[model samples]
Target: MENVKAVKPELEFTDYTNFEAEPIHPVEGLSQRIIAQIPGSSVATRILQFEPGTNTSPNGIQIHDFWEELYIIEGSIIDLELNEEFKAGAVACRPPGMKHGPWKSPDGCKIFEVRYYSKGQ
Candidate 1:
């Protein structure tokens, strides 16, 4: 099915304060505000937030079937597997089946993400 259609009128800037953040299950200190999504599918646009001292070890290494594009909107996070820290302004594009994450944030982080299945999927 096609992605969800935009329901709001065009705006010069979006006020994120109007959106409510919902907790990401099975993982504490992580939450998301979904801006748009295609029901019954993994296709979505969202803002992910990681609270300070949060670690995603419980989730373990992540490998998914959908493409994931992420932009660090603020703060930073460290990839446990890589021992590398990524700060704001950093961006990443992960194709399906790529392994990543199980991250930790010492100072908290905010990321804008888009996830969708590739045409071949």
Candidate 2:
């Protein structure tokens, strides 16, 4: 332990936890950002929705066989590799070790994603 006799410490307290920043810009076609804070990419997570004609950043997720559930709240998306299409009122699930991601839509789409093993889903 080092000596602390020369200077006295100051005490302070405050409570101010809120967002007061400008909202993100609305892209013409697509965009993405975190909707809430979680532990990590694979653990309990929430992401903002992007519209049709928008493209998401290419993300290669390693789920390690962890299952996942997705709710297409609005719009539609086509998984080029899977040769599958997801539209509004549609639900798609992926089994573990699926090697998923890098999704895109021709017209754009909106989706609500719930991740398991990451968010206790």
Candidate 3:
């Protein structure tokens, strides 16, 4: 498929407790809820919430098999790779296999993220 085919689902806040929070592997202090996805594709989208003082990269930073993009919807987080803090309205994009993160959120935060692999990857 060249593009997403399913009609977009209504965007709304689902109960936080309704979704299981899965740890972002190779990282600590962050969890995510997959909100929408398309079948038979690498595409996956989620909301990631961070716990206060959460930090990743105790061992090292992380990379992914897919392109990754994120928008900070609430609060602030520190990007260890950039050594900078990002707050609400901040956006970031990373190509597949790019080294990034080892994040830290001092006061907790929530971010919306989309991840996907290009066709024939």
Ranking by lDDT: 1, 3, 2
**Candidate with maximal lDDT:** 1
Candidate 3 has an lDDT of 0.79
- Per-residue alpha-carbon lDDT of candidate 2 for residues 7-88, written as tens digits (9 for 90 to 100): 2223243321231222224434544333332333443223335555554444433345355677776778777566677789
**What CA root-mean-square deviation does each model show from the true structure?**
3.0, 11.7, 4.1
- Candidate 2, after superposition: displacement of residue 25 in Å? 15
- After superposition, which runs of candidate 3 have C-alpha atoms over 4 Å from their true positions? 1-17, 25-28, 37-42
TM-score of each: 0.87, 0.54, 0.73
Instruction: Please rank every candidate by TM-score, starting with the best.
Output: 1, 3, 2
Better of 1 and 2 by TM-score: 1
Model 1: ten consecutive residues of lowest lDDT: 1-10
Candidate 3 C-alpha RMSD relative to the actual structure: 4.1
The residue-level lDDT of candidate 3 at 97 comes to 77
- For residue 57, give model 2's deviation from the true position in Å: 7.7
- For candidate 2, the TM-score is 0.54
Query: Regarding lDDT, does 2 or 3 come out ahead?
Result: 3
lDDT of 1 by residue, 1-121 (tens): 3454544323456777567899987888999988777766778888999999889999999998888999999999999999999999999999988899899999999999998875775
Against the unseen true structure, what C-alpha lDDT does each candidate score? Answer: 0.87, 0.51, 0.79
